[model samples]
Target: MMPLRNPKHAPAAAAHLSRSAGVRHQGTKRSLSAQRSPAAQRAAPLNLEIEQLREKGNAAFKAGSYSIALQHYQEAQGKALTCRPVDDDLQARILSNCAAAQLHLGQPQAALQSCKRALQAVPNHTRALGRAVTCHLRMGGFSAAQGFIDALRAQPLTQAEANTCQQSKDALQALVQQALARAAKAATAEEGVQALAALEACLEDSHAPCMPSLLLTKADLLLLLDRHQDATRMVLAASEAAGWPQERLERYSKWVHAHMLYSQGQLDKAATAVSEMAEAAADDECRPAPALLPSRSAFAMLQQAEPQAFRDLAQSLTMLHQAKEEGNNAWRRQDKAAALNFYTHALEGITAPPPVFAAVVFASRAAVHRADGRLLDALADSLRSLALCPLYMRGVLRLGQLLTDMGRHELAAQELGALQKEQAAAARAHAVNATCIDLWRDVDAALKKAKEGQRQRRAIDHFEVLGVPRTLCTDDEVKKAYRQLVLKFHPDKALGRCRFSSAIHTTCRPSLAQSQLEERVRAQAHRVFSMISDASTALATRSSRITLEAQLNVAQYRTASQQQPYSPGRYSGAYQPRSSTARASRQNAYSKTYSNDYYDSDYYAYERFWAS
Candidate 1:
């Protein structure tokens, strides 16, 4: 008789049972059937062992002992895959679990590959997709990460799963917005202070990540603000707190120290520091040493031979490329959210730049706004670029596009005609071609339609934005509504990580989502309560009189020059000359005597002496 396979390892049998269903083992008769096949008999014991190991791994993972869980998971994977041919579903599950473990272990690249494999095995596996999204996000593959987020959301999610997804989405959104704001600030010549102020606010927010990288960013901004001491302090503090690998910390600190030295005109010491930093950076694995070539070259040319200048420049370039690639990818994916994030990142990456660089950054931002269907924003950015660099063709083209979209066809046509004339004057045949004319006409017509649509939409007012009733709203009620609206539509809350439940909890907890959402809501409510308490005194003062008083004694002083002398005379011989001082003293005595007599009279009787 043929040997029977172990039913325990059969996915087909497992599929028939619900995940929570109990498994019952048949007795010795079935045990004997397993023993008939040498492979089955041998695999049965290993499969049982693997199952036990998997359970232990899961238990450890739940307890947050990820390292121990990883060991068990790795062992289980080895035993199960070698012991028998696992089904596709089981294989995918194993890969997904392995990827999760790797992610917790901080091996994102390995985790990404594992997740990809898992998804290949089971394309619709939510766990695999989630893991992939997280890994891609960590890797800075933002477009891919966003795509995965969308895909995950499209699937049916349990309440718990949905909450987790929402949290991740919120975190990504916050990061992207922060990156963009930084980019926009960096692109502007005069907005550094405003940007730093905003950045400081972000730093002050306890919930924000205060990582060393972010601190380094602040230090860079501080340097721009000519707050050298503050910048140095920040850099040193960041170096100490980075907790990165030794090489990374050393590389970062060396460059920062070198820059400080160079700024102080310690050229020889700065050069030495720069050399050391270059050597250390060469060996650093976290970031590529070769990628520092352009910066290193530039630093070599500095009058002071300061390596940090080169390093900063190189970092900026790398960040710029990263942002551009990310934005382009997001655009390709048609992910407006991700595209906007990356576009902002790209804009922020420009630190020191020529005027044309600003034009490029603005142009890219306009494109992002255009993609987002925010025509006004797009027009604003494009116009800003044109104002900065009037000769920038891209900005002009984008502005024309925005104008055409806004139904300002006459303006668009004029812009297009100017562009054509400029190009034709330069003998550029391609620039003033039929395609340009066609695009101009099409855009002009579209703009007219868009203007009509906008007119229709513009009929709504501010009250409509908050969906609030306009009838008889009291001052108190209006103030309350405004606060709610601010919390709801404040760009930061809308575009970044405003805890949703917190808004609900503070505004109206009963309407919030159940489970984990309640916790955030309650926290938000507590925050709101504190704010309300703090404002109560001011609010009360609005309708009431409040006074504060302090009593202070006034001291009177007489200078020697102003002092009077009694019985003083310059000459005396029976013909006595009465000094002015003596006359004044006599008058004072007479006045005092008369004043007492007057006070004794009933005219001022029993009145209290009041001091003002």
Candidate 2:
């Protein structure tokens, strides 16, 4: 028989069932004399059919068709229950498989009930016990799970089973540790107490190795709540369980004593005792780790007890700096996700914003954003970092590089050019160092590349820029297209510039400082406006138009020869076919009335004609 809940046996079972089905369809019934017994004959076909359904369910589960797999398991179980003198082992296996499918579908409670039913059929089912332990752990019933875990341990198990059970335990501990940490950071006492109670409920089973961490967390919470005696007791118990020596226990004892004195309004005595503890903690062997001291909550209490001893601003900055270093290390390890989280923590940890540190972390996060293909977010972060610390060299370089990659050559050039001037000023003020010289070279190289991109952009086809056909356009058409483009792209009329100007007039009111982003957008609009003007000039006049037309024909013919057969399209510069009657009528009308007023009248009439 196939192993319980094993999908690997599916193909062989399917093949065997197919052969049997084919024989049954061929009317190969056993003679009465050849049959074993009436009961065996009556039960034989039902058992075979149930096995076939179970195998089908296994195949579906392996194929990731979990809903279909679940339906098959339920149908197989239903059929199995209908048989007289039921096959207990087969029923247990089917129920266990149903549990596995339920678990995969994220129905933990349902899966747990299925496991119970399976175990009811066969009391010592190993697979059912293992799955039940998992369901209980997932539902945060760790104490309830202990019974299943012990039962599974009592059974002889294979190496795979042991490894899986160990992994589940590890996962549970990690989850509990995370929960306790969150409780420690809870904003209100009521919230923290509730969180702690939930954690305690889940952790009633002493077999979990994470109990020491939990005890320490509870001590920290109790201390914050001014339950001095309970906090001290928890600290002592946690210290012993965590294998802390005499020195660490004494330090926490002193801290708890000082906290108690502070809570009872003996401020002077609390100050003296805290000073003594601090002096003792200065000794290298006696120093406690910052996390172990649980100072964030106590630090708040101490502010009222001893104002001169702790500065909140300095403490917050120290924590943010540590987070920044961790972020840098994660970035070095190429773990962008971890690096992003650490940088965000540093940003949020500050009590008073430190410009330099904030700028550095923002710039580092921008680098991660760039690596993850979030170019717009990278651009925003880079600009924000530069706005915070204008002279931050790395931030300037990053923003310039980003602009260049986005084909905003004019903006890239401006950024790099400013850096070049700064580098030159520094070199003149002092002896030129290697670092300064290297930065100068990078700025110079980036500026040159940006200028090259600008030149390339200018060299693109004028007809393409104005959205007019070189082969079919007349002088009037060229002028009209140029006017429309100028209206669309002019700095004064541009969409972004208009919106910003509106804001300045309304809610923004008058302010001495303008947003850096608005300035960049205005500059970009002016650059595009200038490019359009230059393109218009290059295509103006009769001689210029004829020269452009001849040049375009040669380029198009050469391109068409090397590529696929060209059709009459924009790039090919070929004219679309025109009707002879329409061309003749247009020519006759133009010849008879060729005046500016006549053209203006026709234009307005055509506009009115379209409106109707």
lDDT for model 1, on a 0 to 1 scale?
0.48
Q: Count the backbone clashes (under 3 Å) in each candidate.
A: 4, 0
- What lDDT score goes with residue 394 in model 1? 62
TM-scores of all models?
0.29, 0.29
Of candidate 2, the 10-residue stretch with the lowest lDDT total is 502-511
Q: Name every residue pair that clashes in candidate 2.
A: none
| Candidate 2 lDDT over residue span 505-569, tens digit each | 12111111224434554565565667568668877864565456555554445445557775567
Model 1 is weakest, by summed lDDT over 10 consecutive residues, at 547-556
The parts of candidate 2 lying over 4 Å away from their true place are 1-313, 350-352, 458-612
* lDDT, model 1, position 80: 66
RMSD (Å) of each candidate, 1 decimal: 29.8, 28.2
Q: What is the C-alpha lDDT of each candidate?
A: 0.48, 0.60
